[model samples]
Target: MPNSTSILSPIDVERIRKEFPILHQQVNGRDLVYFDNAATSQKPAYVIQALTDYYQGYNANIHRGIHTLAERATKAYEATRLTAQQFINAASEQEIIFTRGVTESINLVASSYGRAFLREGDEIILSGLEHHSNIVPWQMVAAEKKAILKIIPVTDEGELDLDGYKKLLTSKTKIIAVNHASNSLGTINPVKEIIQLAHQLGAVVLIDGAQAGAHLPIDVQKMDCDFYCLSSHKMYGPTGTGILYGKKELLEKMPPYQGGGEMIKEVTFEKTTYNDLPYKFEAGTPNIADVIAFKFAMDFITELGKENIAAHEHDLLLYATQQILKLPAVKLVGTATQKVSVLSFRVEGIHHFDIGQMLDARGIAVRTGHHCTQPLMDRYGIEGTVRASFSVYNTKAEIDQLIEGLERIINFMK
Candidate 1:
C-alpha cells in the first residue's frame, strides 16, 4: 500500500464526494465504484442545478433577440466562454470557439486551417497515442491536400519518441498535432517542448486537451500552442459541448468552418463576409444551455483548485497501480512517469471485455477495448486492456473494492 500520508490528504474529499449525487448510488446490489472517468466525468449537483435553472428560469436563444430572456441567455452563454478563456489561460475570449465536443473542434481545425494553408508534400505530424478523433480528421485533410502524414512513434511504456519526433520535423512540416494526455494510457506528453520544437521548425502545434482539462493545468499563451481543444463532458459539464482555442492570428487567417446564420457578418447571393473571431467558426445556433452550465463545472474545478484535485487523483493512481501490480497474472501498460489517474492493464488468459463485464457484475465500472487508440494497442501487441480511470470523487475505498474484485476474477479465471 502507498503511504496514506504521502498519497492523500483529506482535502475535504468526503464533502466533495457528496457534491456528486451520482456517486451515492448502487449497481448490482453493491455500492457503485465509478472508475471510467476518462469516458466522461459524472456531473456534480451544482452543474446539474445550473442546467435546470437555465431551462426553467431563462431559456432563450441568444445574440439576436432584444428580449430580456434573450439578453440574459446571451450573457450567461458568453460568460462561460470567458470562463473557458480563463480556464485554459488563452490570451483573449475571442480565441475560444464553441463546438459539440473535441471531435468537432479538431475537424474544424483540420478543415479550416488545413484547407487554407497546407499544400502538397507539406507534413502534419501526429503521435501513436492519439484517439481516433485526432487521427481521422487529419488523415482526411492530408488525403484531400496530398499532404504527408507522419507519426511520432510510441515506446513500449507508451511515451512518445521525442528524438524520433525531432527527426520527423523539417522545413516541410506544416503542423504538429498531439494530445496533452493519452486518454487510454494516461501519459502526459511534453506538449510545451513539442510546441517549442515545432515553432522552431516554423510548424504550428495543436494540443488535444480532452483528457487534460479536468486533471492538468493549461496555459495556451505560456505553452505557445497554435491550437488547443477541450471537451466539456470530460471536464464535469454537460454533454455535446466543447471548445477550440486558437491563436488570434491563426484564426483570423483561416477560413470559416461552416456557413450558417450567425457566422456571417453580411451575406449576398454572390458573396458573403464572415463574422469576427470566435463567431467566425461557430456557424449554427450554439449549444446555449449546455454552454451556460459548463461555467459551473469550470467553477467547480477552479474553486477546488486543479493542483489539489490532481494530488488526490494521483494518490488514487498510485494506490491502484501498486495494488494491481501485486497480482501475479496481471501486467500493467503505459508506465509513463507522469500520468493522470488512469490505469490500463491486462490479465493473462482473460479477455479485456470479459474482465470489464465481470467487474461490472461486481458494481465496479471500467472501460475496455482499444479506447479509440487502435494504433497504440497494436504498438503494444495487444487487442486491448481493462482501464480503470479515477476522478476527484473517487476514493481509496473504491479502489480497494476494484482490487478485491479483480483478484477474485483472476483467481476464478485461473
Candidate 2:
C-alpha cells in the first residue's frame, strides 16, 4: 500500500470526497472503483441538482425573449460564461465562447479562423500526442487551403521532442495546435514554453485542454495562448457543454463560425453584420441548461482549489506508477517526467482487451485502447494500452486493489 501521508493529508481527502456524492456507490456487489475519470468524471450532486433546478424552475430560451422565464434563464446561462472566464483566468467574458465540447471548439477554430487567415503554403504544427479531434480538423483545413501540416515527434518516454518542435516552426507557420496534457499518455506538455516559442516564430497557438481541465491550473493569460479549449463533462459538469477561450483581439478579427440567430448584430437583404466576440462563435441556441449546470462544477473546483486537488491526484499517480512498474511482465506505455493521473500500460503475452475484461469482472473500471490517439499509438509501435486514470475522489486503497488485480492476471496468464 502507498504511504497515506504521501498520498494526501487526511483532511484534504475527506474534504474533497465530501463534495463528490457519486464517490459513494456500489457496482456488482462491490464498492465502485472509478478509474476511468479521463473519459468523463462522475458529476457531483450539486452539479446534477443545478441542472434539475434550472429546468424545473426556469426553463426557457435565452437572449431573444423578453419574458420573465427567459430573462432568468439568460442570466443563469450568461453567469456560466462569466464563471468560465474566471475559471481559466481569461481576459473578459466576451472571450469565452460556449460550444458542444472540445471537438466542436477545435472545429470552430479550424473552420472559422483557419478559413479566414490561412492561405496556400502556410504551415500548421501539431504534436504527436494530440487527440483525433485536434488532428483531424487541422487536416481538413490544411487540405482545403493547401496549407502544410507538420508534426512534432515524441520521445520514447512519451514526451514531446521540444528540439524537433523548434525545427518545425517557421515564418509561414500559421498555427501551433497542441494538447495541454496528453489523454493517452498523461504527459503534460510545456505549453508556456511551447507558446512562447511559437509566438517568436509568428504563429498563433491553440491548446486542447480536455485532459488538463480538471487536473491542472489553467491561466490563459499567464500561458499567453491565442486559444484554449475545454470540455465540461471531463471536469465533473454536463457532457454537451464546453468552452473556447480566445484573445479578444483575435476573436474580434475572426469571421463567424456558423451563420444563424444570436450571432448577428444586424441582418439585411443585402448585408449582414456579425455580433461582437463570443456570440459571433455561438451561432444558435446552445445547450443552455448544461451551461448553467456547469457553473456548479466550476464552483465545486474553485471551493476545493485546483492546487490542492492536483496535489492529491499527483500522489495517486506516483503510487499507481510505482506499483504497476514493479510487475515483471508489465510494460508501461508513457513514462513522461511530468504527467497527470493516467497509468497506461501493456501486459506481456496478453492482449489489452483481455486485461481490461478481467479487471472489469473484478468491479474495477478502466479504459483500454488507443484512446482516440491513433497517431500516438502508431508512433510508439503499439496497438493500444489499458489506461487506469485517477481522480481526486480516488484513494490509495483503490490503487492497491488495481495493483493486486494486475498481479493476479499476469500470474494466471503465465
Candidate 3:
C-alpha cells in the first residue's frame, strides 16, 4: 500500500485500471497482473475503440485521394501528427515523421543524417546503457562511413558516467545519441545537460525516448535535441506505429530515408526530385489504422495529465521496491536516484528465466532477459535480470500480489 504521506498527489488508479479491458482477463487461473509495460503497454478501451472505428468506418490510404473516405482517412491520419507535435511540444508539424517504431526512427536518422554529414574518422558517442536498437544503427552507420564509435560508461548504480562522457567529446564528435531514460534500468538521463555539452563541440544529439515517452513529460524544444524517437506501443498506443521528431532545419537539409510513392515531388529516369520535409521521409502506405489509434492513446494520457500518470507510477515503483526489498536473497539492479516505473532484480541462486516462468504461473507477467541491452548486462557482469515495469493502471494490490509470488518462488526454490 502507498504511504499515507507523499510529495506527489495520488491518481485514481482503480478508476484508471477499469479503462484497460485486457486487465480484466485471467492469464492462468488468477487475474493478470501485468508488469511488462516497458516491453509494450496494454491498450486502453479508447485506443482499441479508435482502432475499430477506423477500420470499420473509414479505412483508406491517406494523402493521395479525392474521395470522401480518402479525405476522412487523410484528415484522421494528419490529426495524430498534430497531437504528437503538441504532445512533444515540437516546433512544427513538418518536423514530425511517421515510422514503424523507435527502431525505424533511429535507423532513419542513422542512415540519412549519418551518411550525409558524418565523415571518415568522425566520432559518434553512445552510452553503455543503450538498447540494441540504439546501438546497432549507429554501428552500421559508423562502419559504412568509417566513423568511430565512443561510449559513455555506466556506473554500478546503472547511471551513465557523465564524467566519462565529457572526456569522449572533442572536435571529431559529430553526433551524440543516447536514451532519455534507460529501458532496461529505467534511469532518467540528464539529456538537457548532455545536449548542452554536445552543442558546445558542434555535435548533434539524438535521444531515444522509447522508455521516456509514456512515463515522462517530453518537450523537444526545451530538451533542444536534434532528434527524438518515440514508440506508440510503449505509450499505450497500437504497435507498428511511432514518430520521429527532428528540427525542421536539420530535416530539410538531410536526405529522405525511404524512396517511394508519396516521397517524390517528381521522378524520372533522368532525374528525381524529393518531396518537402515530412512527406519526404514517409514513403509508401504507413500503418494507418494503428497510427490513427495512437491519437486516442495520446488523448488518454493528455486527459489524465502526464504529471498525474508519473505520480501514480512512481508510487507503485516505491511500493514495489519497499516490498521486494523485504524478501531475502534478492539483489536490486539499477538503483538510480531517479527512474521511471521499472524495477529489475536478480536472485542469488535463481535463473531469471525460471523466476519469470514461476511468476507467470501466478498470473504476474514480467520480462526476463538481457532486455535487448546485452552490452549493459555485460557491464554489470550478469546474464540478465527479472524486470517488472509499472504503468498508470497498476495498483498496490497488484504489487502485493507480485511480492507474494516472488516470496513463494524463493521459498519453493530454496
Candidate 4:
C-alpha cells in the first residue's frame, strides 16, 4: 500500500525557513536569497543533527562486524532503503541501491545493465535536455558495446518532442534514459508517457529523478520504469549519498557495478561470488552516516506533503517568472508549460557569469552557466543560462529581492 497521509499546506513558509538555519544568515552584509536549489538544496537542522548523532553515537562500519555498534549501524543504514522506497513509492525496499549520487547511479546502470544486455546495433534513446551524468555514461557504454545513441529532440519551448521520440523507437532500441526534470531548465518531462512508450517497444527505461525527488510526486511503480536515480543532496539530504531504484527482475539480471569488500559473497584465489539484490551494486564501506541522515530528509518531505510543496514552489515560479520577464533586456530561455520552480534566462548582451557575480554581491545565490547540460545549451544556441530554482522554504519575498537585483543589474548593464 502507498504511504498515504493527509495533504497539508506546505509548511508555513516562515516556520520552514526557521528549520533551515542557514537561511537566517546574511551574506555580504545582506540577507541571503538562495536560488541554487537545483544544484543542491540546503539541508535542514534535523538532517544535520542526524549525521552528528550517528557519528557520536553508533559510528561503525556496517554489515561485517558482530559488535553491537556495527549491528546498530547496519540497521540504521538499511532503514534508509525503506524510507527511499516509500519516498518514491517503489514496490519493494530491495530495489533501492545506495550510490555516491545520481551520476554514479546512472553509471551503475550503464556499466552493469548496459554491458550485460546491450549489444552492437542496439539503440539507446535519450532526451536533448539530459544532464551530462545521464548522457556521458550511456555514451561510454554505447561506444564500447557498439550500440547507437539517439536523442529525443527538444522543442523550442524546451520540451521533449514526443512525436520525434516515437519516430526514433524501433526493435533495435534496447534502452531509453531521460531526466524526470531537467536540472538546467526545470522542465518536467512527461516521464510516465515516456516510460510507457519505451515499454511498448520492448525497451527498458531509466528516469533520472535528481531534480524531481523533493519537488514532485514520484511513483516508480506507477511509472513502471526499469531504473530510477536520485541525489540526496538535491533533495535536502547530505551530499555523497543517493539511491538507484531498479526493478527486482532487472537488477537480478545486471552484473555488479564494482568489486569490493561488502559486495562479495565468497572470494578465493579461484573464484568469487557476488552479494544479492541491492548489496551487489553497493560496494565498499558505503556512505553510512549520510545514508542514515538521508532518511530524515525523506521524512521531512513526507511530513510536508509533496502536493503542498509543489503548490508553494509553483507559486514562486509563476511570481518570479512574471517579475523577471517584465525586466528590460531579459529573455527567458525555457518557457515550458510544465516546470518546477526554475527560472532560466539570459540578459541581452550581458554575460551570465557577470550577472551571477552581481547577484552574489547582493547576497543572492543562483546557478549560472551550462549547469552540466552543455549539450542542452548547444541546442538552445547559447553558452549558458542564469538559473534561479526555488525550494519549499523559499518565499515570495526572496523572489522580489531577486527581481530587484536583476532589474538593477539590467539597468546598469544597459
Model 4, 170-287: lDDT tens per residue?
9999999999999999899999999999999889999999999999999999889999999999998999999999999999988898999899999999999999988888889999
Q: List ranges where model 1 is wrong by over 4 Å.
A: 1-10
lDDT, each prediction: 0.93, 0.91, 0.94, 0.93
* Model 1 agreement with the true structure over 1-414: per-residue lDDT tens digits: 011232234457788788889988899999999999999999989899999999999999899999999999999999999999999999999999999989999999999999999999999999999999999999999999999999999988889999999999989999999999999999999999999999998899999999999999899999999999999999999999999999999999999999898999999999999999989998889999999999999988887778878998998999999988998889999999999889999999999999999999999999999999999999999999999999988998999999999999988988
Deviation in Å, model 1, residue 164 alpha carbon: 0.6
Model 2 agreement with the true structure over 126-235: per-residue lDDT tens digits = 99999999999999999999999999999999999999999998889999999999999999999999999989987899999999999899999999999999999999
Better of 1 and 3 by lDDT: 3
List of clashing residue pairs for candidate 2 = none
Backbone clashes in each candidate structure, one number apiece? 0, 0, 0, 0
- Tell me how candidate 2 scores on lDDT: 0.91
Residue 90: error of model 1 in Å?
Answer: 0.9
Task: Judging by lDDT, tell me the better candidate of 2 and 4.
Answer: 4
Please identify model 4 stretches exceeding 4 Å from their true place. 1-5, 8-10
What alpha-carbon RMSD in Å does predicted model 4 have with respect to the real structure? 2.1
